[model samples]
Structures are given as C-alpha cells and as structure tokens.
Target: MPIPTSNGHASRVQIQEPRTRSPLPPSSSPIAFKEQQGRPPPAAQQTIAGKLSRNLFKGILFSQLTLISLLVIVLTIRGLILASSHHFHPKKWYPPLLASVAVSGVASLAWQCIFIYNPPRAVKATFWLTPILTCSVGILLVLIGSAVDAGIGAVFVLFAITQSLYGCWITPRLEYTDKILSLSTAFPPARTREVVSLSILVSVVYSGFLVTGIGGATSTRTNLDLLFVSVILISLAWTMQVLKNVQQVAISRARYVNFAHGEDMDAWGAFRVTVKHLIGSICIGSTLVPIIVLIRGSIRSVNLMSGSSDEVMYSGADCFSTIANKLITYGNRCGFVHVGTYDKGFVEASSDTWKKLRSTVGLEKLIDSDLTSSLCFLSAVSVGAVSSLTAGIWVLLIHKDYALEVTLYAFIIGYFVGRVALAWIQACVLAYYVAYSEDPQSMRFDGTIPNRIQRLQLLSARRDNRELEVGRDRDDTDNC
Candidate 1:
C-alpha cells in the first residue's frame, strides 16, 4: 500500500519535469524556413515571364522582316517583268524611284536588326494598327479618286502611297521608343482624339479659305485673293506649329523622365507643360514666317516671268510651297531638339540647337541618321503602295461613280489621321536622340547599354576627340 502511494507522487513529478524542461527550437524558425521557400516561386515566375516576352518580341520582328523581304522581292520581280515587256518605262522619275526603294529596303533591314538585337518587352497593337488603318484609308481614297476623275484619283494615289511609306517607317521607331522607355501607358487615346478634332477643324477652315481664295483669284484676279490666301497660309501654319509643340512637349517629357530614370509621368503633366510653354512655342514657331514669305515671293516672281499662265503658276506655286515647307520643317526639328535636350523656353532652345549644330561636327548627320529620313521615305512609300493597290482593287470591283470625290476625301482624311498617330512617335524618337546625344550613359537598362547606342556613343566620342586633344595641347602650352 505504501509503495503504491509513492508511485502516484513519482508520476506527477515526471509529468511536471517534462512540461517545464523540454527545450523548444528557436522561435518561428520553421515558419521562417517555410517563408524563405515560398519566396522563390514569385522570382521564378517573373524570370519566366521576362523570357517569354523577349521571345515573343523576337518572333514578331522576324516574321515582319520576312514579310517585308518577300514584298521587296515581289516588287523587284514585277518591275523587271514589266520592263522586259516594255510595260515599264525607265523614265527620269523611274531611276530615282527605284533608287529610293532600294535605299528604303536597306534602311528597313538595318532598323529591324537594331530592334531584334535589342528586343523590347512588347510591341503595342496600336503600332501595327496605325499603319494598317492608314493604308486602308489611303486605299479607300484611291478607289474614290478613280470614280471621280482619273487626275484626281492619281493625286490621291500619290498622297496615299506617301502616307503608307511614312506609316511603315515611323511605326517601328515608335515601337522602339515605347519599349526602350518602358512606357506602359500606350499612346493616349484622348490626346489623339483631341489632335484629330483640332486638325479636322483647322483643315476644314483651311479648305474653305483655299476654295474662297482660289475662286476669288480666278474670277477677280485682284490683290484681295492674294490677301485671303496669305491669311489661310498663316493660320494653317500657326495651327500646325501649335499642335507640333504640344506633341513635342508630351513626348519629350516622357523621354526626359525615362532618361532620368524617374517614375512614369502622367498625361496631365505632359499637357500642362505644353500649355505652359504655348506662348513661347508659338513665338518660336513664327520664325518660319520670313522664310515662307520669301518662298511665296519667289513663286510669284517666277509665275509673273512665265506670263502668269495658270498651269505654270500652279506648278511653280506647288514647288515653292514644298521647298518652304521643308525649310520650316528643318527649323522646327532644330527647335524640337533643343526643347528635348534642355526643356528650356522655345527661343532659348532654338538658339541652343543652332549653337550645337554649329559647334559639333557630324552631329547633324548623326541626328539625321538616328531619325532615319530614308526610313521615313520608305514608310511613306509603303503606305502609298498599299493604299493604291487596295483602291485599285475596289475600283475594279464596284466601279463607283463618286470615286474621285471619295479619293480626295479619303486622301485628306487618311493623311491627317496617320499624321496624328505618327506624330507622337516622331516626337518620342526626336527626344530619344536628343537625350542620347547629350548623355549616352543615361539610357542604360538594367545597368546595360544597348549595342547600337554604344556604337553611337563611340562615334560621337571619336568625333569629339580632336576637340579634347586641342584643349589638352593648349593647357600644356600654357604650362610651358
């Protein structure tokens, strides 16, 4: 009985000892191990996604390149076959056109290579859609042109072809900018809508003025018609300049933020900056006035010399307008470069751009190459070709009566629409070049610079070497 009682006391003592003295593993150690194991799947998923995106980009690029190559081959073969049958004439215009085509093809291939080698995350659907829409509209215009009048249709076809080529060339550049900058926010639909609305308004007003001035001039042959024409020209120029400035500001800010490695900028900020600089931009834009006046005067003098014949006058006027527009465009480009580089007032920016151009060797060429005028020409050609072909097919199918009017309207509509879409890309590309020119290092992604950019930087460095050497020599001479 006494042994049994002692056993109960011993059992209690054993239970209390185990409860108090059993050692626990370090607190939350197992939980932390599980957490560490859980973390890697997310990282692994991210890695997989990145690789997939890159692969998809490369695939799209390759497919596009293949298609373009096939198109070029087909075109060349068609031209050759036509020439053999005496259907194709090697006129003065033919050689230049062929040369342009060849150059554009080469430029396109080069551009594709650059993109593939440095593949961005994704190409926006809009980039592809813009050109397609542009071409479609152009084609529609061409069909309309044929129905109305052969001459009008021909003009519409020409315009459509030019627009198509521009779309092809510019779309890629825009895609590159989007990818390079990691601009998740696609082209602002609202901004595009606004531009379209404004452009339409201006175009309508300009068209009215044109009609009125032409009729008045033809009927009255007075100074009043000329005055109306001048008003139309000035107003149209002013509106275009304003729109251009707005686009530049928006794109440049996006580029600037990207270059500085800052957080993404919103549309409102871009719009505000544009509005803030509106007056100054308008003033800077007006610098084109003197040049325009000189062009118009020269055109008038030539017309007078030609005895004011209608056909001769029209041709001369068209030629002069083209020349003047080109000059204005180049000037505007310089201004845009300055704006992108320094984000300064427009006048200051213009001066700065001029100074940079004057001071730097090969800088102009570099800018032109980076911007790729040949590519632009090619793009315009592509757009035009597609449009013309489409329109021709439609004309063949339906044989509509109002084809000429349709062609004219379509040409105008498509050109403006495509222009608006591409303008954003153009502005972004301009800003990209400016930023690169100023500081090539700032465009690094993941601490790595693109090979093309590196090559550019190397070239720029070589160009500047003489200047650096001269400075060094002068310093040594002073020391001596």
Candidate 2:
C-alpha cells in the first residue's frame, strides 16, 4: 500500500476513508427490531393485556386530573365573584362573610368525621341515621314552639337552617358525600354539583334582597321585622324543597342497587313513590308553616302601617325614628328577658296584640302568632343562656319577652331530646337488620377481608412492576 501524503506531492498517494457512525442495533429500530424478534409491529399486534393496562392507567390519570382541575376552577370562580362583588372587602361584608366561612369549614369537618363514605352498609347506616336525627330535632322544635309560642320555635328553626346549610356546603367539598343524597335519583356527584351551583345563586339573590329590603322594612309598611320574616319563610320553603330532593335521592339509590341485583325496580317507579312521600311530609310540614307566617305577617304589617293606630307616626322623620326605636327596644328586651321577668311583663302586656291566639280547628290547634314575637324571645333566651355560662357574653346578649324566653328554652331542650330519640331509633333499625338480614351480596365478601386485600395488593404490585420494566427498556434503548 502507498503511504498517505498530506500534500499529495508524491507519485502515488492513498486517501483514508472518512469515518461515519454505525447504525443502531436491530433491537433498537422500530420495524427492524420487531422483525428481528420474530414479532409483529407493536401498533398492529400489541398484546391485548398490555393495551388494556395502558388504557386503564391513562383513564385513571385523566379522571384524577379532571377532578382536581374542576375543583380548582370552581373555587377560583367563586373567589373572583366574591371579590368583584366587594363581598371580599374586609370593611364591608367581612364580618358576616368570614363568620359564615368559618362556620361552613367547621361543619364540613364534622360531616366528614361522622358521615364519610365507606362500604355500602356503613353508607346506609350513616344516611339513615343522619336524616332521622336532624329532621327529628327540627320537627320536635316545631311541635314545642307550637305549644309554647313561635318565639321558641323560631329560634330552633334558625339554628337548624344555619347548621344544615353549613353541613350541606362541607359534605361535598371534603368527603364528597351529600346529606341530600336521599332526595333524588340523580347521581350524587351530579346532583350535589347542581345543588351547590343553585344554592350559591340563590344565596347571592337572597343576600341582595336582604341588604336592599332592610331600610324599606323599617318604615312605610315595610320593617326589617317583616322583611326578615319573609326571608325566614323563603329559607324555610327552600329547605323543604331540599329535603324533598333528599328523599328522592334515597329512593333512587335504593332502586338502582335493587336493579343491579337483578330486581325489577325502575327509576320512574321509585320517583313516583318518592314524590308522594315528599309532597305529603316535607311539603305540608316544612313549607306550610313558613308560608302561613309570611302571609299573616304581611297582612299584619300592611294593616298596622296604613291605619291611624297609636303606633303609627306618618312623618318621614318620625316614622324613621319610631322604626329605629322599635328595633332597638325589641333587641334590648330580647336580651333582658332571660335575666329577669322584664321580658315576661312585656309579653303579657302585649298578649292581646302580639300574643298567640290559640284555637282548635278539627283535631289540631292553630296557634297564630307573629314571627317577630317568636324571634325576640328565642333570641333573648339563646343569648341569655350563653351569657350565663360565659362572662363577657352578657355584653353581646339581648333579652325579649317572658313567654318568648320560655318558648326558646323549651325548643332547645326539645331539640336535644329529639336527637337522642332519633339516634336510638337508627341504632335499633340497624341492629335489627344486621342480626336478621340475609343479603344475596353477602357472598361477595364471604372470604376473610384480608385475603381480598392481599389479592388486590398483589395485582397492584404486578401492575407497578410491569410499568417499571417498560420504562427500563426505553431507557436502555436510548443509551444504546
């Protein structure tokens, strides 16, 4: 061979070939590697098992991400709306708004602790127990208030409404459970989402009405007292509707499960049955009371303002002053009622005017009384009871009339008693079924729970290992 020359000056010169990198191994190439292994192309002849696993993983990842994203978007929207409405400003609505937020947070935590979803049996137990307990307290308070006076009943209703709403907001956020799950055949996820959306809209409207109506209600046949009563009525009616929905949900869940178990239960059939019960119970019981209160209060307010009664002061300034004094005096008396007999004196003195008119129609007694009379006493008793237990609470407390104070006291005591009774009933019902029940699905968990758990764990581990192996293969091919 002739020597290579740098300057090509020699008679003969050899040129070295330029270096070029070797192509990748057949194992690394998309088509060639597959052919080398005597296997079909992955896209065309992918193993069914591998494809299924990949699809499942992708689905799980997508679902998890979607849920997280949805939650974030909802929260962001709510925050933006609140901010734009100036409700987020600390100077304006912060006190009540913050209070509501704090209450809602705590309520949510409580619901998660008590009613978080687990197995079917646990879910049923929780659902049955919660409604009976909550509704019983509410009903008992109503019954007691009827006997004593509205003042007593009104206090319980207010507490029940607030607590219920707080629980409602919290359940979906934390535990993804709904107390109203018993109300409709709509899926809990979908139903709760709708309910929350609707509730937010309703709340905003209600708040706007409240803010605007406050001044108008204070004079000219419109007083905060009457406006507040209207609000309470609206709230009560809304609550009843929610309760009806809750019943429908329960029936739907039951029918769905039944159908899944090869039974003949259908959604429409269950819905009809649910509607009958809901209309009979919640519609009649919850909605009626508030509606009647609203009507009576409206009539009373219209007549009082239009008439030349001793209470009427037609001058704008005089009317404003009178309204203000009435409010202040009412608030003050409500606080004072529980401490001494001052509230009782005022209530007795106004028995002909604001006192409850007891009359028996057929088998039931219709006790007609104004919500104002009821609220004053209820507020005073609650305030006083709290004040008595705590020192500085006295400063924040108000007193109302004697009958109202006693009525409120009775309502609170009745609620406590009702809770206990409801709990006992649920326990009894659960114990009865657990002891004497023979369910077909029992075979599903016939083996020791630990054995099933172990199987699940093994499946998970195998899946994880397959993923790891696939990842490792890609990394090796890249390095090569």
198 in model 1: Cα distance from truth in Å? 9.0
TM-score of each: 0.41, 0.25
Candidate 1 per-residue lDDT, tens place, 260-371, comes to 3333444344545555433344335444434544664576566557644379677876776577545544454546544433344444555555554434444454454343
Q: Which stretches in model 1 have alpha-carbon errors above 4 Å?
A: 1-148, 155-238, 261-264, 286-334, 337-347, 354-363, 371-406, 443-450, 453-480
Residue 102 of model 2 has an lDDT of 28
Candidate 2 stretches with Cα past 4 Å from truth are 1-102, 105-114, 117-480
Model 2 C-alpha lDDT versus the unseen true structure: 0.30
* Global lDDT of each candidate: 0.41, 0.30
